[model samples]
Target: MTAEPILTISGLNVDYGTGANGVRALRDIDLTLHRGEVLGLAGESGSGKSTLAYAVTRLLSPPGVITGGDVHYHRPGGGEPVDILSLTPDELRAFRWQELSIVFQGAMNSLNPVHTVHSQLTDVLTAHRPGMRAAERTARAEELLTLVGISADRLAAYPHQLSGGMRQRVMIAMALALEPEIVIMDEPTTALDVVMQRQILRKLVELRERLSFSVVFITHDISLLIEFSDRIAIMYGGRIVEQAGAAEIYRDPRHPYSDGLLHSFPALHGPRRELTGIPGSPPHLSAMPTGCAFHPRCGKAFEPCAERVPALAPPDAGQDREVACWLHH
Candidate 1:
C-alpha cells in the first residue's frame, strides 16, 4: 500500500538575487515525500539536487537564497504542520536538525574531527530529546550504533579514527537519533566504493523498513536510484523535466533528458543499446535559454520547445506521471 505524504512541496521557485543580478536555482519544482518512501532526485553535477535538499531542510545560507516556494511538512503524530519557507529565524532554529534531518554529500568532513562519537551523539540527543538522562542517552546512542550495523563500543573513537563507510554510518545514526519523520540524504554514498555503497544502501533499506521515515534521496547515479527509490525526478538546469515510478522511468523515459539518461546506462539484461551522453553542459542560471530550459541539449527539440516552457502534468502514460517537455506537454 502507498503511504500518505509526510511532506509536500509545490511551485517552489528559489532564486539567488534580485533585478539583473538574479540567479534562479529552482523553477517551479514540485515534489512529495511519504512515510516509507524514497523519492530520488537524479541529475548531473550542479543540477540543483543539493539545492532542493537544503531548501526543504531550510538550510540554505547567504547569497544562495529561496526567493519563493512553499515547503509544507507534516510531522508524525500531528505535532505541527509547517510551511518550511515561511518561518522566522527562531522557529527555523527549532525546526532544523530535530524535526528535519539531512545527511550531506561529504559526511566525512561534516563529522566533527575533534569530538568523539559519544560526545557527538549526545549533542543531538541533548538538543532534541532532553527528557533522556545521561544513562538513557548513552543507551539510545548505542542502539543507534547497532542499528547502523556498527559496534557501540566505537562511540569512544573520534571521527578521524573511522573508515569512510564507518563515518557515513555514524552520520546516518546521528540523523536518526531524533527519529525525525523525514531525512534528506544528499549523495550519502558518493565517497564510498561499490561494495561499501551496496552495504550502506542495504542498511538504509532495512532501517527505513524498521523505522518508517520518508526520505528524499539525491544522487547522480540513475542505476542506483532505480534499484532503491520508489519514484524519481530528473532535473535539468534548474527545472525538473521528468518524474515517475522508478521501473516505469527506466522502461519508458518520456523527456529528452530522461531518455538520454537511460541511453547512458548499461542495462544488466538486454541487447546492449548504444551509449550516448547528453551533449551540452547545463546552462548557467543567470543566462538560461528561452522557453524550455533543456531545449539546447534536447535532440528532439523543435520551435514550440524554444518558444514556450512546457507545463508539468500527467504524461501520456495514462497514469500518475508528469514530465515538462513539449512531447508530453
Candidate 2:
C-alpha cells in the first residue's frame, strides 16, 4: 500500500476578505506531498503558485486568509496533525524551520550583508537547537556547508564577499540548518544566471539524496521543472489544471495551457531562438469570470468551458493524471 502523505491539502481556499469584499486567490485546491519527492508547481506570474506555497507553510501575510478547507501537516515528531490554517503565532514559531522551512527566491536577501557565513549559519542552529553549545553549532554548520559542496573555510567570509552561486548555496545551507523533513522552494534560482542555476540544481539533487527530504518547488520555468522534479502540477489562474509525472506532462500535455507553456520556451540549440509567450496574462483575482478562469486564453475553450468550471477528473483509471479542462475531462 502507498504511504500516508507528509503534506496533504484539500479544498484549500484563500480569500482576500469577507463576503463581496472577497478576492479568491485560491479555490478548491488539493495537493499531496510524499516523503523524499519533489513536486513542482508551475505557472505564470499571478497564477497563485506562490499563494499556495505561502498557505501551505502558514506564511501568508495580512489580508489573505484561509477562508475554507484544510492544510494538514504530519511531521515525524509524533504530535497531532497540525491545522496550519489555524495556527496561533506561538505555535507557528515552534513550527517554522523545525518542521517546515522555505527557501525564498532572491534568498540572498535572507543572508545578512555584514555577517560572516559562520555567523548566519550559527544563528539558525542556535535558534532551532537551543541546547547546542558553540562548538556543536560550529560543527553542525560545517557539516551542512559540506553537504552543499562548499568548504568550511568560506564560513569566515561575508555574504557580499561570496559569488552569486556561493551566496545561493549558503542560503540553501541555512534552510537545511534545521534538517527539516520538507522544504518549500519558491523560485529559488530565479535571480541566478543559467550556469549558477544548474550548479545549485545539482547541489539540491545531491542534498535531497543525502537528507531524504521532500520539496514543494514553485517556478514559472517548465523546462527547469522537467529537469529537477519527479512530478509536476500545472497551475493556471488560482486552480490546478493538470498534474502528472514530469515526463508525461511534457510528452503529452492534456491541457492546452500546459501545451502552450511547454511550447513557449526557446529552442535549446541550433538557433537558440527568441521565444514568444502565451497570448494574455493571468486573470485579476479581484475580478474573475463566472466560468473557467483560463477560458479567456485557452485555445480549446468552447461553449461548456464558458458555463462550467470543470473538476480535475482523469479520463480513465489507468491514467493517474488529473486535469480540470473540459476538453480533457
lDDT score, candidate 1, position 269: 85
User: C-alpha displacement of 68 in model 2, angstroms?
Assistant: 1.0
Candidate 1 colliding pairs: none
lDDT of 1 by residue, 1-329 (tens): 16677888888887777778878999888888776799999999988999898888777776777777688988766666788888898888777777778999887578889999999988988877778899999999999999999999999999889999999999999889988778899999998999999999999999998988888899998989999899999998888888999998988999889888877878778787788988988898878899998988888999899999898888765788898988866
Worst 10 residues of 1 by lDDT: 1-10
Which stretches in model 1 have alpha-carbon errors above 4 Å?
1-3, 77-80
Task: Please report, in order, the local distance difference test score of every candidate based on alpha carbons.
Answer: 0.87, 0.86
Worst 10 residues of 2 by lDDT: 268-277
> lDDT by residue for model 2 over 1-329, one digit each (tens)?
13557888999998877788778899899988887789999999998998898888877787888888998888765578888878898888878888789998778667888889999999977777899999999998899888898999898999888888888888888888988888999998998999989989998998888888889999999999999798899998789999998999988998888988988997675656556567888889887876888889877789988889989978567887888888866
